[model samples]
Target chain A: MWCQSCREEYEERDAGTCKECYEEASETEEELKREIDDLKSKVAFLRLVSPLDLISTTDLLLHAAGSSSNANPNSSPSTALPCTPAVPAHRAVLISRSPVFKAMLENEMEESRSGIIKIYDVSYDVLRSFVSYLYTAEVLLDEHMACELLILAEKYQVKHLKIFCEKFMTSKVNNENAIGNYAFAHRHNAKQLLEAALSLIMDNMATLTEREEYKELVEKDPRLVVEIYESYLTRQVNTAAKDSTLQP
Target chain B: MWCQSCREEYEERDAGTCKECYEEASETEEELKREIDDLKSKVAFLRLVSPLDLISTTDLLLHAAGSSSNANPNSSPSTALPCTPAVPAHRAVLISRSPVFKAMLENEMEESRSGIIKIYDVSYDVLRSFVSYLYTAEVLLDEHMACELLILAEKYQVKHLKIFCEKFMTSKVNNENAIGNYAFAHRHNAKQLLEAALSLIMDNMATLTEREEYKELVEKDPRLVVEIYESYLTRQVNTAAKDSTLQP
Candidate 1:
């Protein structure tokens, strides 16, 4: 018979859905597309003009605290990376986006009073991207940038950015980086990334001890390495129980 | 053959799609749904805490100008309707959401200087809902509220909110209210709502002149009524052209 969709002939065993169901599915798809278009427009509307564009409204300056003396290649020798021009942002926007910022700004903290926030352990570029993400909910991220932003997102309790970075990292997870990613995820409480990385590690358990990351993790945090073994043992027991049930 | 979607047996002629096409479509649907979920989360993240919740951060106050003097049933006698509390808002949010507000605030306008904007001809409830929508991109709307907000949205040049209101009003349009909605939509420059209402009006051309709204519309805006007749005439011409071609 001729298929309504794709206009192809299919054998009886290769048939998918009935004509009524196909029509219903098409309607559902159209409705879903309409909803997506509406949401995209909303996202565009809600997006604030990046503080980078308009400095007049900025109420706070964020400095990358530890980057000044790094002598980074991204910075010129004369500029001394530390004074890399601070990212300007609005207090209201910061407060709305991050609970850490809200509490710090709302209280009589030095940063609140001085209108300057020093973000520790972040490079100037990363800090700029992080602050930009707060305003626009967007960032062009590589794996390194994703990991860096994930740490910042976690530290500031920006759940949305954290999830975004975690998802990116999770997608990039593989056999080689699984151990390292698993360790990073554990440290940052990235459950999704942790699960993805751990699943990859478990799938290649035969080579688990051969990886340098696994050895480094074992040395750095023996407890994390033990947890991996525990999970592997549990998975083995579960599989064995399932196999026994099937035999019975 | 058994239909995969509904698990129902179907005749040979009732087939919808081949298995490969069905699987691909299902995957596409899943991907679309995931995209929608991501967009929804982004919207939620970008949405600000309503200005009413945090007045300390608010830099502007909006008054319902004509509402205070109206001693309508909606307001209590003791309050005299004039003392309706002003809706507090943030200038950054207002500017980002509406071009009218952006220009007014960015310039040295009286409202910008005074930190107070008086929205003309809107009730206290509608004004509050309007400001709330500015922050959250959401509103609980009935027909009356939708119309009121649509007018305010148009006045303020909040295109997102205006489109939202227009979509709501367009969905509610029918033969009974088509004439009134058409007039309202035309005034607000709501093209979608106008077209929907006009289409309904044209479809019921036989009963158009008999309706009380038709008489009211003719009395109120004879030009709009004339346009409706013009559209009907054009439709008749196009139908005749098509019919004549088919006959040949």
Candidate 2:
């Protein structure tokens, strides 16, 4: 018989779905595509023009603290990184996108009154991207950028960008980085990344201790290492119980 | 054999695709659904809090003209529609959503200088819904609301909202209202609704002239009626040509 989709011949045992089902599936696919197009347009429509361009109405300036600045002299000029410029943003956009910003800007906080926010441990580039994401819901992410933005996203309670960064980082995780990622995930409350890292760590439990990250984790946070061992033991007990049931 | 989707038995002749194809298709569907969910989250994230509550930051006021007010006495007090209080909105949001608004706000237009825009030929409720849609990309619509919003959407060049309203109005088009909808669609430049309404009108051409709307349309705009007949004639000629080609 012919497969309606691929238009290739197939044996009876290899058949997938009937003609009626195939037709229905095709229609469903078309409908889904149309819905996606409509949604893409809606997303485009809803996305704000980045406040980066329109500083006329800006209510706040975010400075990237903990970066090299002209005021700081210990860092030599040639080797020192360029000072990160302050990013301009609107209070209304910030409040809408993040609860952290909402609180900071809405309540009579010092930052709200001063209209200046110092974001520590973030470079100017990352700070700019973070603010841009708040307005546009978009960012170009590499693993390094993803990790940086994930931290900022977590700090500001931008759940959408946090999940987006987490998904990217989780997809890039492997045996070498699983232990480190697992610890990072735990610290940041990234449940999805934590599960992915823990699952990879479990699958290669035989070499768990030999890894440099595992030893560092043991020294840094013994409780986390203990939790890993506890999870391994639980899995072993569940497997043995299943084996016993099969034998009976 | 069992149908994988419905889990029901089917004859050999009813088969559609192979097992591999079915698995691939299911995976594709899952991927598409995941994409849809991601887009939905992005839409939600980008969506602004309704400007109604953010009046502190609003830079403009929109008054719905032709609504109940002392300016027009014919609209009696008891029977009159309640005056639509002026809706406050952000200049940034206005400039982002509609090109007309962007042009008006950016070009130092009178409205921009005054920070008050008078929207002619709209009721207060419809104007409120239109502004809410600009902020949230959402509005509940019945057929009447859909038509009214479509007109506003067109006038403002809010293509996304215009398409959304047109789709809703098109779905509600039928034999009874096709002529009226077609005329409305033409006036609004709603291509999708216009096509849907036109097709329905052509299908019922036999009874077209007898309908009261047909006569009203004839008196109101004979050119649109002529276009409908032209489309009907074109369809008839194509059908006859296809039939003659099949005879050989």
Q: What DockQ do the predictions score, one after another? A: 0.66, 0.67
Residue-wise lDDT of candidate 1 within A43-125, one digit each (tens)?
Answer: 99889878876576577899887744554555556753355789998888888899999999889999889898988789889
Looking at the true structure's interface, with contacts defined as alpha carbon pairs within 8 Å between chains A and B, what fraction does model 2 recover?
0.70
Top candidate on TM-score is 2
Per-prediction backbone clash count:
2, 4
Clashing pairs in 1: A68-A82, B68-B82
| Stretches of candidate 1 exceeding 4 Å from the true structure | A67-82, A244-248, B67-83
Best by DockQ: 2
Question: For candidate 2, lDDT tens digit of each residue in B28-126?
Answer: 888889889999999999999888777776788998867333454434566332356889998888888998998888777899898888887788899
True contacts kept of each: 0.75, 0.70
